[model samples]
Target chain A: MQHALILIGVLIAGMGLSVEAGLLGPLGEQVGHLSATLSIFMVGALLLSLALVFTPNRQLGTLFKQPRWLLTGGILGPVYVIVLTLATPLVGVGMTMVGILCGQVAASVAIDHFGWLGSEQRRVDGYRVGALAMILAALWLM
Target chain B: MLLPFIFLILLAGGAVLAAQSSINGRLGAKTGVIESAWLTFIMGAVLTFLLMFFFEPAHEATLFSVPKWQLTGALFGVVYMLAIVFAVPRVGTAAATVAVISGQLLMSLLIDHFGWLDNTVRPLDGSRYLAMVLLIGAIGLIYLSHQQRHRRMVNQPG
Candidate 1:
């Protein structure tokens, strides 16, 4: 039951960005993708900062010695918001989602296979490949 | 012709999203998840602030006048990003993503079917349900593969 609750929480949480889709459209129309993207980060950053204040945390300075790539991880979220904002109108939501899913699955598999970007390397075995194929088909079926 | 090209571009955008969990998850391992997320927002905020200037005339007046709920999108970003950072390392990025996507598809289907949030109501039909079932199957396959990999490693000689 506890596991089911967590899974349910994750599901509702997954809707966050999609729910944002409705709001961002008007926001995007008002300000453009760049400005809209800025707004989200600003709001998100503020919220996160407030949350961090209560939590015990590491010093950001230590991150400098770790490697440049770790610090660069911030770019992906803004990039996704910006790209999705721009692409959605051109392709429509359905195609944009399909495209995004395809890209995500492909890139994920590659990232796991190559172990790029500081992740543990996992080989793309036959089952993994087949699973990916099924995902693609399922996406098309959607 | 151009639309197909645009489709491919959108596809690549999706690919970046897939990488997002693992990237942040790894950062979480180093700085702790909350701090990693905090740093990411800081960097991203700086980056987008610069880009915002290039866009010019940034609807500042309109944004303030709009309902407060419209702006709550970023709060969701916080939850989703933090969750990804936490889930990725524990479950493996691939498996964690499958879980995330499952949630996403289900939610999206509801939004589509009921037209929640002022969306146009599109009835959920048989095919969409089938697609979802296939997705579950895909998730199963992915999860099974992870289990097998673990089993194999365990069986290997010390």
Candidate 2:
């Protein structure tokens, strides 16, 4: 049940990310693409700061302590926004999303199996491989 | 034609990287929901800033000249992140993913077709609908695979 919950969480997160992407797409259409990208992250940073301020339990110091990890993870945010923004204008939102999902499945398999960068090691088995294949096939069809 | 495909691939790669970071952030044994969110965004922000440093913008005023309306999109991200943390534990990953994608597809269609969020009106066309259908079908297949695995596990002796 716990495992199932985690999986569901990831999926929901993915979906949320997707919708978030869709909203940004139209916003990008209005603001120049680069400006839109910067604004999104800047706002994201501001939002996080506000959350940290309002939510007393979380320690800002903890985030600062591990600068390397935070930096590495932080870089992904902008890269994701930029690449996704770039992709949308070039290949429409739908195709760019398909491509994004394809990479997600492929990278997820490795990340799960190898436990790279301090991730929890979830062993990849036949079931996972089969699931991956299905996702890939779906991307191809998309 | 090919350029779009290439761009898509790049987008996918970025998404994957983002996913890996999420997993990593959660790996912290004592991390809670808010902490996880904070770490993910903080890390993501730093990376974005660095990239901005190296990649000179085509428009000089890009960083400073953001419009007020774009800020609304940030609220969407916040809501989406919260939904993810809340929904994942209830529905299971595969099912939740399908539901979320389904919602996104439906919403995206409306946005694109109606020109919501200040977009140029691009009438929903056949090709766009076809692409969405394909995406939905793909999400369905993923769910089926998960179900098959679950059934096999249930049938197996502990």
What DockQ class does candidate 1 belong to? medium
* Index of the highest-lDDT prediction: 1
TM agreement with the true structure for every prediction: 0.88, 0.65
Candidate 2 regions with alpha-carbon error over 4 angstroms: A1-19, A64-67, A85-95, A121-142, B1-12, B15-24, B27-29, B46-67, B82-103, B110-115, B118-158
lDDT of 2 at A60: 51
- Per-residue lDDT, model 1, residue A7, is 42
Alpha carbon deviation, residue A90, candidate 2 (Å): 6.0
Worst 10-residue lDDT window for candidate 2 chain A reads: A133-142
lDDT for position B74 in model 2: 63
Interface root-mean-square deviation, each candidate = 2.7, 4.8
Which residue pairs come into collision in candidate 1? A103-B15
lDDT against the true structure, per candidate, is 0.75, 0.55
What interface root-mean-square deviation (Å) does model 1 yield?
2.7
Candidate 1 ranges beyond 4 A from true positions: A1-12, B56-61
